[model samples]
Target chain A: MIKRASAFLLLAAIAIAAMPSAALAAEDGELDAIHHSANAYYLDFTPIGKLQLPRIFVVQHEDGSYGLELFRSTAAAILEGGWVAEIDHDGEEHAEGEEGHAEDGAQEAHAGEGEAQETGKYAGITLAQLEGHLVPPGGGHVVLDMSISKHLVFAWLGMIVVAFIMVRMAGKYKRGVGRDTAPKGLFQNLFETLILFIRDDVARPNLGAKTEKYLPYLLTVFFFILTCNLLGLVPFGATATSNLMVTTVLASFTFLLTQFGGTKDYWMHILWPPGIPAFVKPILMPVELLGIFTKPIALAIRLFANLTAGHLIILSLIGLIFSFANMFGPTVGYAVAPVSIAFALFIYCLELLVSFIQAYVFTMLSALFIGMAVVEHHHDHDEAHGEHHAEPTASVA
Target chain B: MTLFAASLLAPDLGLIVWIGLTFLILLVLLRKFAWGPITSALSEREDKIRESMEQAEKALAEAKQLQADNDKARREAEAQAQSILREAREEAERMRGEEVNKTRDQIQHLQEAAQTEIEREKQSALDSLRQEVADLAVSAAEKILRENLDADRQKKIVKDFLSDLPKN
Candidate 1:
């Protein structure tokens, strides 16, 4: 599985690198191809910056019929030249005005300075190139103007729809034993197995008889994390869990549960533990309190780091092919493309597995922590049984 | 970099809204549809197992009862066999006693008969002897009278003989 993931990651990297940069231009309308010479195609990367990025031209124009080249330079540059032409056209008027008065000449100099200041205000501001070259034979200009960010919006919508579908399928399984009899579907089997695992392995063992009361929270955490993790694997989807804010909020909830559910015994031990040396209590209390805060912090970082690392690795592998393509030519780029694409595909599949594992680990750990807080120590019972009860030590406050 | 920071810092209001709504709906659905039935089913299964165990215990008790009855029957049959044997022995003893008594009576009767016959024979013998002796004496006296004397003596002797015979 690991090898396959690596192979898929490599292949995906290569495929991403080999994709035509011009395709990106199709999304952004404010870019135009100004000139092409020999081996290099000079195209505006963004009209905001006249900085050129390398690209390939699929079609050419003749007689400047498309007229897209008109917006190539900034409006400021054109206006600067227009001022020179205006000065030449007004040469006769300027000589006539100079003969009228020396005071008038001083006023004209002030007016010219004011005009220069106005020109500077509008300097470097360019009109956006929102048009494209036309195709041959009874042609018209192609205008590329659409919201590029809409892709991310659609991706989020897709995630929600998929989540709904999964929830519905899980509901079907929950509805009847007949549906549960066949554990063939992915979501159904996953949900059923997770429910049983949490009930028997984590919740029952830790929470014991009262585990049923807390099963809903445990199940919710597991499915919620799983959904977010899986969503991150889809192409162009934002990783909500990869964001620190999301994980932190989740960890905070766990912290709240742990604190709220804590038994009197749990708090007592944290505050004034039995059988501890008199001098040590003061020092131990602070350390115990610090430990309490770190629990949620650790939960937050563990989830955030794991998810972010996976995404970074995928992104870096794809980036490697781009760097390689730039260093060499398309030939080496093409040759290595397959290897990187295969690796990316492999990584995507691995992410799917990681998604479930991370979710399970998070839920299990949360249950464990909550269990610790609420668990009855039974020190009194032990003492009554005529056995030597160990002194209860201070834990997280 | 600024755009990235802005995007990150921006509150995910959409997510919070969606998640809160989704969680509420899920909680309601789960409470309504899943929890009650699943728990009850598990409890029911446990009850069934316990019931079957109790049933098996009852069956075992009944089996033990039948075994005790069979033992009792065997004991009763043994006692009846002994009683029959005892009755047969008593009957044989009584028959033997009757047979002995009858044989003793028959022996006694035979002995008495033998003794009576012996006595009768003895008496008859004595009577016959007396008769024989009297006849012999008469023969001798007649011979002597003939020799002693003739007519006169014979008359006197006849008168005396008649008187002696009347007296005898």
Candidate 2:
């Protein structure tokens, strides 16, 4: 009884502890959930604080010459890099008036210049405004804003972690640990299970003799996506796979491999389609070509949407407590916390399943696409397209 | 909220480049350090297992063959031993029969020689008796002639002589 009571108290304490951040977000008048899941210029280690990431921008100067700007942090960008955070209510004309004022008082109030910086046109633009859109000096706009974000850092971390474990496992194999004998340690056995699963189940069935050729890529994709997906569930960690761009690139790799590795039969099936009538051949060509792109596009969107939606759901469930509090009182918030957290916990568990499932789905689809592209089915159309088959038979005779 | 919503689906170029570059590097590095060795080792282990299994099966078959050969040799040795014992028994029976026949013939020859010796001795004894009887008769006749007695006296003498001579 005592132990159970203590566990319940602990749960309640954790629930209550998480509410302050919710309250803080409510005070700031923003949906903390959206803010949490959105891409940001800094890492939000809530309760500890945000760590600002460095920003890099390619800017065009007024003289029509291009220049690159670098900042150690977003704060440094605002303070030292002659940039300022744009005010929410300020329009362009108001910003222009402030730019003139900033030009006048450039040297005097440079230190305490919290309102705007001395930069002429982009004086009033804030860090939020300059997030993906950093305007340049002297009427020149930003050619490219190549700032590092939280997702990128997390992505690199995931990569490093996966690489470290795999390389260490590989070292054991090289030393004849798993090679000569059974896999000894936890890491070796665990990795071997997953690796073999990918080889036998995923790659071999789809890739056939080409399994070895594509095993590395399949294994890499599986572990990398799995690690990234799991990283999102970690506290203060972001899901890199949740990013559309990340999935897009991954899917595009599959796209490139599929196209390049395509066999002659694959092209023939798409272009000429031996079984199809002459009238339908042209129509089928466009559809087949479109299918080539849609496959990868669907791959990207499915992974991105699944991760994002899962995170959004959990975040929303947690946000419910704050929404109730803002609408009613702290009492109401406290009342709703348990139910909100219970549901969030449930969804969080579901998200764990979703993470694995999404990774597997992506890799499976990729393999399937590649498998379809390289499939050699000489006899598939023999029965269905007997007209074509009869002509070939007659020619042979 | 709308801005954030838009940003959610927005594809960031920097992120794209980072993901592309880093993923490629990861793929290359993992292929070198991890996948290559791991897969080769797995296949190597599988091959070793299969080879050992095949060797075990071969050894088992060899053992069975040796057992079968030993059984055949033992049966052949037993049959040879039985045949030798039967031959020895037949030879003993034939020799015993020959010995019995020879002993019986020797006994018959000894009996025949004894019979011939007995016949010869009987004949010789008869001849000697006959000669002795003839001499006695001649002496008795002379004695009777020399005495020249009457007929009655001669008759008594002959009777008396005959009674005294042989009690025959």
Candidate 3:
């Protein structure tokens, strides 16, 4: 066990060391320069431009305000794209000829500039500039640039291979081979226990008879989210889930499924609920309808916020080491690094639990909503009201 | 606020495409391979656990039954031993009574023999005494007659006495 742990630690160290630290330093320097530039003072916020993708730039203003700006790359690309963009703060389109002239001048001036100068122009880019420019951010700029792309790919592939091995291990157990009778591999045991837990604890209780129908989706979501979350915890890995776009996409699927699978009773309950007074129905109907949309929205925001916050916290802690390093020199920086890394690691472990928890919460809520929608709702009426008109002959008899 | 608004307006077409494709593939694969067997295995495991519990319960009951049977057999053996001792004691008492009856009969026979012998002895002694008394009486009578009368008187008394005696 010690040997395996040490090996993993060593690999992690190598992976961390392999990050494009020089490149990140260069980007940070460029961003700092842009923040202090004369143009930065004029702009509302200094935008962090795409280090690689020229068209995609994050604009930053004078007061450190930021937004995304996307310049059209290819005309065909614009037609295929569906993102909404507005020029500057106003929701108006810049005349085509006017926008073209501005973009051409900026591109020509910066075309021959070195990497440092280019970074300066593009530093502190915000979400608005990305939208305005019609350029989507690469989802991995926070950790490293192109230099560490290979390592990121390696990690992603490694996760896939791990997942495949786990599934194979589960398959071996399912073939009537008991734990002792079969090859007791580590992957097999872990995967088996996890699968059993999901089946018994999550799927069975929530989905019931139809659990089998939904198991695959639940397991996939669980493992995929878990893998992504754990990988983010790695020293140099980019947190995919931290990006709102990624989590938004995931939540949208659940939303769509819930909406499409909603039964008539689900609609009835939302539109005209039982038991409310006639006067209160109007007030409650809107609230009930809003709940239907808000549920999925909450699911999306909760996951995105939790994951992004974890990343920000870790980065801030690491930034502390750098800030202290400047004040106290390299010795203090190196000394503080281990402590920061330790805290980061502690948070990373917590993230692992959160990853599982979030996946469970998402799947469980989906099942509950689906279950509620699919099941029938029974309404009880007052028997006294019905019996009020009963025949008076009964009293005579 | 614009970023937030634009984000909401964003169609996310690429994301939707990728997600839909991935979800479809996952759904198919899971339905084909994962769900059925996993549920069955879980149910099977539950059944096995319950069955083992039942078997354990039955074994415990059997053990208790065997213990009770052994206790009953031990009790029966103890009872048999006590009855055998009682029979042996009764036989011993019966033998003792027979021995006592035999001794009593022997004592009675001895008493009868003793009584007969004493009676015979008593009769003999009486006969002897009577004979002696008779001899003494005759002698006394002769002496008295010889001293009191001459030879002819003595002869006349003797002849009278002899004739009286012959009549007794």
Candidate 4:
């Protein structure tokens, strides 16, 4: 049973990893799929088909009143709200915005909408890119789109999963299974170990005595990022961590926490290094301040890029098989499948490892940054520097 | 909305807000529902184990001290018993010597008394013999004077009397 399950798991992993490129091969992929598999507002259960999510928009009316619009699906939203697509005036001359459909493609989308008018979700509501915001093409200004996207939905699901696991684990611990005695189950043991790792290995070493204050954020980020990353690996799921907005928010939390938690010494060091010669302070000040901003940026990008790159490589590898088919023949495509799958499987495993590593990196860096901020530094100049660099000491570089 | 295709890296403001809210909510949730109990439990368990360990060490030290005291007491008792036994033996020897000396003195005293008594008896007997000899000599002298003088017999009696006298 175990063998079969494992084989099925391996096969399923390869297949899920390969599907994005396959879908793109059938229709050349968009810019979105390069980093992470993009999901439409529709949910795909694979065996079943698309499940169009409810569309919600808080719109600013032309008359200056606000309204909340809810539609069963995007098609319903367009049909009821009288929306259209924003087409570029010139041929292929467009600013950087949402995907620019070619003229023919635009018309097809219109036709699909016309056909879907009678039906339900054959088409979606038209959207136009206006200065990086997705506004209704000719509709009221969109103040906020609380619409559930692939990532948002997955994020909720991930949150739910984290909550359920943690809450249940909390219950067990509350009953004293963990506190009074040894933890009994695997999940209990695993979470305990991971939590302790974050506490002792990450938070304590970095944040020191004030570790308890920032530990919750560290743990939350870890579980949240880890959950999002793993959830994306599931069949028909998109990685929320692969999204820039998601990673940015996670990093910004650390950034805000670090800033707010900053001690006198932390701020002083950034604003003015103690031992540096007076003349060089201004020159080094910008560099020091830039380091602060760069830390979180690096944190955000590191997580986003790592997760996105995993899918990109996997999708490209799968794309290779089709490219070979086009180059040689069906025979070559047939021959390429095994090699493509083997490499995809290898990369899939690597991606799993990377997922955890990325989560760890994100959490660790956050703690370190917060540690750098909140850590109390002694007034004895060099000793102050030494204090921050004290425990779990390593070159931050 | 097929809107993500335009620019991949552009920040989704809606998502940013949603994630911000979601993450904050999650932080509160986990902190309240999960981490509060779990972390406290872990630390509580740690403290309990640490306390038990300290208690064990203290107990062991106490036991070793008790053992040392027991050994010392046992050693002292053994030494006391040895001294008592030696004292009893010494006392017995002294008593035996005293009794032997007393008995020897008593025997010596008894022998001296017996010797004195025998010497006195001998002297009295000798003195009595001397008196009897003197009376006999006087009486014999009277009888011989009264009966007529026989110088040879009288001389023989004197010689026999002198020969019979104890050596002075």
Candidate 5:
């Protein structure tokens, strides 16, 4: 195990060392495609772009009433619904022409200079321009554009896949395929192994005796995170786990479970520590309270950052090839191509590992936190009260 | 530079709501269809495995017990066969000794009776021969000397011969 780890470390180190040579002076279009986080809610095929998902928006109208609208594409929304891009909101400027972008100062700073305006087919010009700046139609009421995004679509896709696979596995198990007999075939074996792993390696150890009670939730979370993470690695696929809102919701589940799952003993230790003197309790209570919030926040941030960072690094590494080509000449660009691709491939492999590891880490920490809340520790056996008789409720499985 | 350097950093509240609702629905649905059956099946499989192991152990113990019983029965049968063989050998020896002693007594008695019979027959033949010889001598003396004293002489000769025999 240690040998494998060292080999991985060496390869990663070599890739990092080789990366800096060509990581400069990339074209505006290349950087925007690779580095810029904002992408139109469309599937970018291998050479360029492909299918665009439906655009759903919660927009406010001139009548001061919010409305939900759906469009087949962003172009339809703009042309049919009279929605305008941020740059064209006042009707003061036509879409920027190709020659005009060369003279435009602000557009020159951002790599994708007038790329959105140059295109006549795609709507909203570029989502980056519309960031927090979507004006209501006729400027009559406040509008919160709750538009369905690429990541949201990916999130639903991940959820559907997880559900489909789990339901099938569950059906197999229900049919005694793996119960009374030895687990058969690839799917059943994989099914049995993964669930058993969570039960044995993750749930049982962390949650102790309460492992059975919370096993369902732990299994769901693990598989859901795994599916979402793996979905991101697919070509033209957006990673839902990289999104803050999605991770926040997932972590919030853990937070909710941990807080509500807490026993009186667990709360007592935080609210009023037994062994500590009265003077020390005041100073410790706030810290303990903050700890409750921090656990989930940390869970959320850790997953989001790890997933997002891996994608960014891979994007940056691939961007190096174009940067080199633009900087020197075609020969130098061709020369650096192999090295840049090699590094990007290495980072890609690392991201693959990170996907599984991050899912595992999130599930493990969630289990640990839940266990801390629910499991009755040996230390909280004070013989003070005979009155409190509420039955401790175990959190949802 | 763009004002939002971290464009993806801030989460939209609507997205959170969408995720929250989606996850809740997923949790409820999964708990019913997926987790319920999956966990129960897993536990059922575990129970089955444990029961199978216990049953196998029981069967092994029963097999071992049967082996012990078989050994014990074999030992008892061997001991019974050995005792029967010894009894048969001892009875044969006793029968042979009794038969030998009775045969020896019977042979000794037969030998003694035969000897007595032979002695009596010899004595009778001797007596008859002496009488015959006395008659013949009488007849010869009468013919030769024409004397009537032959009968008395034959009788005296026979009596003298019988008296002289120590066997009487």
Candidate 6:
């Protein structure tokens, strides 16, 4: 077991070490670890190069009319199309026309002389500058940049993979593999275990009799988050769950379900809590109200931060080797390689564990929140009486 | 750096719209295809298991009841058989005693009859002997009378002697 584990970690370390070189190449030889985790317009398949996704923009022309614009890629927009980079004037107004860069004032002045001859707006700026900051020609701004991004593609992949696996499993059940008889084989058994875990351990315990109603959503979110989380750990793959927008949307679904499915008892507990002292109700009311929104917000932030933090740490640990190499010589870099790889390996394993944990936690918490909302509170009176009964028992014991 | 940080924390509209749209579709699709069958299948399996268990228990109880009924009948039959045997044995003993008493009575009655018959026969024989002796005495007396006395006087003497011997 130990041998296999180390070998797996070694393979993972090699994969991780091989990764940053591609990301580094894209960043112009700078080890900006943040760049790897950040959202981008292209999928970075390092060693092979980057694939630019299509860019779609809702644009407003100088005539104050709205129009939709489509480009095959950032390169396409700059070269064939009429869009140019919206470079914020950094005093580098001139450098070179051929290089398409305006450097410092001295170079900008040199390029400005050349700019006088050229009339096109795309004359001075390079493709790198024009990549993310594209603007419509003739003094118009982009209204909405509805471009497909790298993370979005991976998120779709996660969704598709989950849908395929689940549909196949469901097909087996529809044919009476598990419905009439015992579930058979590894595929059915393995997925059944996860599905059962989400249902029995996660949903049923909290949602109670309403488990059936909420179980589908719980199962979907759990697998979705897990797949997205694991996708990030693979080479050249982005973590969609690490994105705030995705987490927010997920948490919002829970929030909506909680609010809509809430019983009168749930609202009553929040609005006018039973059995509280009359004076304390005023202070507690706001807190209870705030709790409704806070729960989902916390849900969003927790999953997002957990996923993002793990990626950040791994990136940073890998970034250490480069930092050491720059500070010392190549010899020191080589010396620090094993240490950084080992730490990265540890974090990677933790991340694999965290992927499952975060998925479970998110689903469990969602079920709990929804359960709180929908569950009938017959225990309110019992709870008061029980506390009274509990005190005397404590004294007797 | 600040722009980079802003972009990092920024919620992109396009991504949010995309995620919302895709996730909703995912939920709908999965709810229909995946979770629907799986959960129902599970519940169906549970129900089947529970039903078969109940049936097995019912069969077991029935078998136990049948066994008890069989045992009771066997015991009742044995008791009846025991009484029948005892009654047959007692009747046979009573019939044998009656037969023995009847046979003894018949033997006693035959013996008494035989004795009576023997007494009657002996008396007859005695009478016959007396007659013969009387005749012999009479013949002797007649011969003596023929030689010594007259016939009328001899006959009268014999008659008177016969009468006086009986009286004596």
lDDT of each: 0.53, 0.76, 0.54, 0.76, 0.70, 0.78
Residue A257 of model 5, lDDT score? 93
Candidate 4 has an interface RMSD (Å) of 4.7
TM-scores of the models, in the given order?
A: 0.50, 0.78, 0.58, 0.78, 0.79, 0.77
> After superposition, which runs of candidate 4 have C-alpha atoms over 4 Å from their true positions?
A1-36, A85-139, A382-394, B1-6, B103-168
Query: Model 3, range A218-239, lDDT digits (tens) per residue?
Result: 6666666666666655543455
C-alpha RMSD by candidate, in order: 19.4, 9.1, 13.8, 7.1, 7.7, 9.0
Candidate 2 displacement at residue A108 in angstroms: 32
The prediction achieving the highest lDDT against the true structure is 6
| 10 residues in a row with least lDDT, candidate 6 chain A | A91-100
Q: Quality of candidate 6's docking, in CAPRI categories?
A: acceptable
> Which fraction of the native contacts appears in each prediction?
0.02, 0.71, 0.12, 0.58, 0.55, 0.60
lDDT of 1 by residue, B1-168 (tens): 232223334444333444444445554555455544444444454566678789989989988998999999989999998998898888888888888998898889888888898888878887887886687468547854674687777677765665565342
Tell me the fnat of candidate 1: 0.02
Encode model 5's per-residue lDDT on A102-202: one tens digit a residue.
33423443434244434435644553443323444566443444566677778788889989988998888888887777877988788779889999998
- Model 1 agreement with the true structure over A1-397: per-residue lDDT tens digits: 9998998777565435322232132221111111110011112222122231111112223444432222222232234322111122133234324434334444544453343333333433221111111122323322321111221232244345545654565456456542424445666566556667877887886677658767767766676677777656653344556655566767777788889999997687678655667798788888877867788888877887777666656654554454455458657766775776667656756776788888887887787778767777676632442232221112222
Q: Give the Å error, residue A59, model 6.
A: 2.0
* B38-72: candidate 4 lDDT, tens digit per residue: 89999999999999999999999999999999999
Residue-wise lDDT of candidate 4 within A1-397, one digit each (tens)?
9998998788676556546534443322222245236534656543344466777788897878898878776555556655443444342223212344454444443443343333334434332211122356444688887777778898899999999999999999899998899998879999999999999999998888999899988999999999999987776777899888899999999999999999998888889877757998899899989988998998998998898888877776776776576558879877987887778777887888998999999999888888878988666775555454455336445
Better of 2 and 3 by DockQ: 2
Backbone clash tally (model 6)? 3
Candidate 6 ranges with C-alpha deviation above 4 Å: A1-30, A86-127, A379-397, B1-3, B87-168
Residue-by-residue lDDT tens digits, candidate 2, B24-78: 9999999998899989999999999999999999999999999999999999999
